[model samples]
Target: MNKHGLFQGGVAVVQPIDRGMTKMLDEQDDLYTVLLEGKLAGKKVQEHEIVESINETIRPYEDYQAYLDLAKNDAIQFIFSNTTEAGIAFDPQDTLTARPQNSYPGKLTALLYERFKLGKKGFQIIPCELINHNGNTLKEIVLKYAKLWDLGQNFVDWINTDNDFYATLVDRIVPGYPKDRATDLERAWGYHDKLIVKAEPFLIFVIEGNKKLEKLLPLKDAGLNVVVTDDMQPYRNRKVSLLNGPHTTMSPIARLAGIDTVGKVMQDKDFYKFINDEMYQEIIPTVALPKKELVAYAEGVKERFENPYVNHELSSIALNSISKFKARLLPTFKRYVATNHKLPQRITLALASYLKIYGGRADFEPQDTPEVLAAFKTLVQNDDYVTAALADAKLWGEDLTQYTGLVTLVKQDLQSLDQGGARQAVQQINQKGD
Candidate 1:
């Protein structure tokens, strides 16, 4: 948000709250200053400056009393947090009396309780955690802490009635502290700042809230890509289907093809063509949103994948591929099946690749549930692994074998992979589709 002119107008003060993870958080708190320097890499104007230098102080976790003072003085009206995906967890051990509770939601509960004691009005809490329903989840965890602590029904009432927690989807490729380019950037800028953030020009903050939040935040006026809506399902759907779906589906294929980074995968003509065709032809049509909006988002995703500044490793993207496929791609697969009365060719290919990557026969072991790993291991020992795997509803949400010819196609792809490796399998699959 500081990238935009939101902070310049003095509408709000950007206060930092420590939420653990010593290494990364230490860097952020150490600098307490950020130099925004990067180009909008795509077809956008290279000369345009979207981000500027902004300096802010990070209050350490030890300064809990200071936060209490701020609460008493009505110095804060909004709370913004990016505590990673795991930060909003509920720790049953957390209590109200501690200087600051360990968990993010725990700390938040303490702070809110302090404010409630002071009879202060509620604050707009926006959590930038990557998890779905971030604000709702945070609020839920906070409320759970309150109940566990027995902080009184009045405090709970104040929390439920007064506070506004906006569920937000924040998108930006902020490859922090560009160490590789730091020297060059320092030379160019004629300054030495260790706290430089290299980010893509494309940014989106989709906030799920009412008109009150829209009025409170002047991000739109500051020329930001901020959208406030009563329902964020469509935006979330677009993000999952376009951005995350590609990452999940493409990771196995890319890794099997000996590609490392996502940008490198995009550089490959065949891989790029496959991903683009998968998105536009298979994924977009299955998304419930309008075709025009989905197509535009898909185009943006393509640009993001080709970003020269971000080096997204296929290994990183391949984490928890089992659950990721379930959460990100399964719905699309089911939707495609419902609409077309047949399994999607690209999705099936991706699925085959996914199964192959985790069959305990790949070069690198895949990370997944132990139960799932064991299941896959059992399947690999079967006489016909593809048929058995496809029929196992325990892995996929439903029986994939129910779809006509899907099991055969998966078996064929797996057979081709066994015969000629990933390259040959990919080529053969694409050729069959063609």
Candidate 2:
């Protein structure tokens, strides 16, 4: 809205209380700089001083009650939020009388209820959280809060009838704050910008909605890669399987091989082929999207991973390996087994790497839930730790040992990893074609 003057309406940004940030925004007249880097920098304006004093329309609000007041008084048409994954949850302790509820859903419920009192039309809610069915999940929590608060059936009916919750998939690499070159950047821009953000050239915003919703928000008109569709499952699956699956599968193996960053992994021939084969052979085959589109996205993922400007650390990607494995790779693993009626060798090797890292066989410390870490400690003591770990339903949400030949394959790979290490194991697998 700020860049192209698409929406002339007032835009208020509500944030959790941050005194300094709010003060700065207020002082600067709601202006912030976005420094586009990488391939897309010079194609458009290199530095965007967005929302620069257009009637001072965009202002930052930290006070929850004040936000509610703005919602009550102003004709708020849309609400966009990126409150993180944990933001959309129900808080049992939240009440209607609380100044501001703790959870994002609770806060939204209060705002919706206030609107319900005034008989206003529901706002178009589009959440940018990186979760599956984020809009639906948020709406579910909001309804749960309404029930807990004992809000009447009429309010619930209004919520169901009026509100529009849009599930969205946002893909971008915003490596915020160029701290290393901040002084030079400030000197070049001839101004001090405390909230400048650095981002990559690529961006795709997929919203699960119809053409009517697409017309309402002309993000596509703004020359962005925004796809509004009735079904976003294919796009979602493509992102999870191709983009995230590679990260989860390669992180532990690369880290175990003493690789620190994704660019470094891509630089190594063995590691690059290992990841490329995993995606094309194992992961891409299981995704629901068209093969051409999936391959294109996978190629783009490779480019993004190889971006020298973005130092994506393997350890950062390795956080919560157990759950990341389940969410990112396990679906593709099961699908490959069901379809091929055999093991996906690369995915199996990835699983073994995960087990080795988490099962105390590697030098790395695995970060996961305390229960998961504790269970691994005991499972590793067993001679058949791979079998024991696979059989534990609590860890994988299912007894993975039940899959045909999965345990045996993973065990053999784990043994190979234990004896020869990750890089050697990767080379051996690459040399032995599937």
Candidate 3:
């Protein structure tokens, strides 16, 4: 909506009742500049320009009552949210009478209830949270809250029958506020914009819906990479396998090899080749989408990862890596095994590098839940640590030891990494033809 005049409406920018944050946004007049800094930067006439050319009003509101008032007046038609993965969860402690409900679902339920009282048409909800079936999950939790608060059967039926919750997968790399070059950017732009956000050229928004929804939004018609489909699983699989899988797989290896940002990893020939082979050879084949489409998306991912302006740190990507591995790479690892009846060498090596880093062998701290960290502490002490880690069903969600040759392969990779370091292990793999 910023770059192109896709929608013509007032955008209510709601913050979480933060007085200071709301004050800052108010001072800026709810205006922000998005610095296009990568491959797509050349497409635009100017590198730094307010893409909000359309005469759209952006009003910042921090109170829940303000949002409820918008709904009460039927000012809201579409709802979009990105409250993180944990945002759409249920909190039993949340009540209807609170100033604002604790969980995102709680707040949404209150808004829906207010709309219900007015007997207004339901809003088209599109949640950008990074979770499987995000829209459905959010709807379920909202209904749960309705029952908990005894909001009535009529309200529940209205929620189920009226509203359309779209499960969406959004892909973009927004490294906000180029602090290193902020002074220069501020001078060049001829203004000190506090809300400047830098981003890569790549973006894709996949919403699970039908042609009717496509007609409603028309984001695709506006030349944006927005796909409204009945089945979004294949697209989701492609993103998780190709984009996120590489991030999780390479971060530990790169960090262990003394590389910092993702750009530096792409600059290294061996690391780049490893990531490419992992995606094209191992990950892409497992996805249900067409090979050509997957390849195109993978190429875009490569360009985004190599964006010099975006300093995506390996340490940040390495946070909660255990869960990330399970969500991103483990499925590909299993799929490659089931499809080809063999181990994916690069992915296996990634798993081994994860163990090495979390086991305290590398010069980096592993950030994860306390339970995961504690489990790793004991598992690494065992002589057969690879077997122990793989056998711990609680860790990987299943007994990975059940898979034939996975244990032995991961152990061998761990041994190779321990003896010769990450670069040597990568070289050995590269020497062997894929």
Candidate 4:
């Protein structure tokens, strides 16, 4: 087995210490743990068999106590998680009394208590769950567990003084298991493992909190985008809005353009420029980051979309469309309209694209079949259909009913889409933006 992630497949023979320190580190979906150390060092390993086939003379992690001892006594640490928005939640029934504890946080608190058993203060924990303020949320849960179990003031002080919890945002298109090329991929790694973290060549980690981590974890030392700041809001906004906002709004449109994946869409001159222009002019101006950083971010986004190894399907990114719009795009739309005194044309086209796509499939499934999508789903292909779609307040998260002109604009774009297609609608919106 080529223990060093080095390969002769035309890629440079560089043995990445952390393989970009990502572990694909995606959270949406994955095959298994990507080992960065031990004998398997550079090779991607089967997540399930990773602990079972141990060549080293070390015991496998047994429970929360194992984590506690490792982090405290042996000075090892890990951020264990299921990596879903639904997974990083507080469990009402989970308690210190329960063996292994039902909730991830409760189990984690027990471990923290064990690690601080010696009464010293120094551990930095960064959670990667997709929840809002993931690290803070976990800390809140840990405290709740402490109170629930009557763990005493000493433990609470230890928690406050001795450890640091960081909020971090991880970005990468880690689509798991290249089933189509699993055999060949496995052959390249010299293994029969199927649990691999398949991802794009792109990676970005924004760690906002605790400079103490710089002393140990070398994510920043490696020149990764690991920012240690007192505020995570700007980073969150930049990623959710500028980096993802345009893509979220444009994916369905991309799919409808007869494009299968983001990589291909990036190559399509019209779609590519449409997305780039939207992010720069419409979305970027509305975000909180500086113009310079935003521009650089947009440039890199084009490369991420162009990563050849990543098969980032347009439809896959289109899931949870309603939530995505509300969380990612809706606020930006409001900001753009509020500050600029008018609606952003390209974004509205993306929204209108959603309605048109929702009423019926264009090339991708509607983001969701929620009431908003459902209402459009009912409209007949009559002249009033586009107008009818914009009246739903439930989807827009506000009474967009008042924005009649905006509605008219969206309708016009939708009409153009019906008459010409995505390219023409995009062109019309660009002209309108100008």
Best TM-score goes to which candidate? 3
Per-residue lDDT for 193-227 in model 3, tens only?
A: 77787877678899996467876777888888998
lDDT on C-alpha atoms for all candidate structures: 0.74, 0.79, 0.81, 0.64
Span of 10 residues, lowest total lDDT, candidate 1: 46-55
Clashes of 1: 0
Give the CA lDDT, 0 to 100, for residue 72 in model 4: 59
Listed per model in order, the count of residue pairs whose N, CA or C atoms clash below 3 Å is 0, 0, 0, 2
Q: How far is 325's C-alpha from truth in model 4 (Å)?
A: 2.3
What's the CA RMSD for each of the models? Answer: 5.6, 4.7, 4.5, 9.5
TM-score of each: 0.72, 0.79, 0.79, 0.63
Better of 1 and 4 by TM-score: 1
Greater TM-score among 2 and 3 belongs to: 3
Using lDDT, rank the candidates from best to worst.
3, 2, 1, 4
> Model 2 over residues 328-364: C-alpha lDDT tens digits?
7888989999998998888788889998888777886
Model 4, 230: alpha-carbon shift in Å? 1.9
Sliding window of 10 residues with minimal summed lDDT for model 2: 53-62
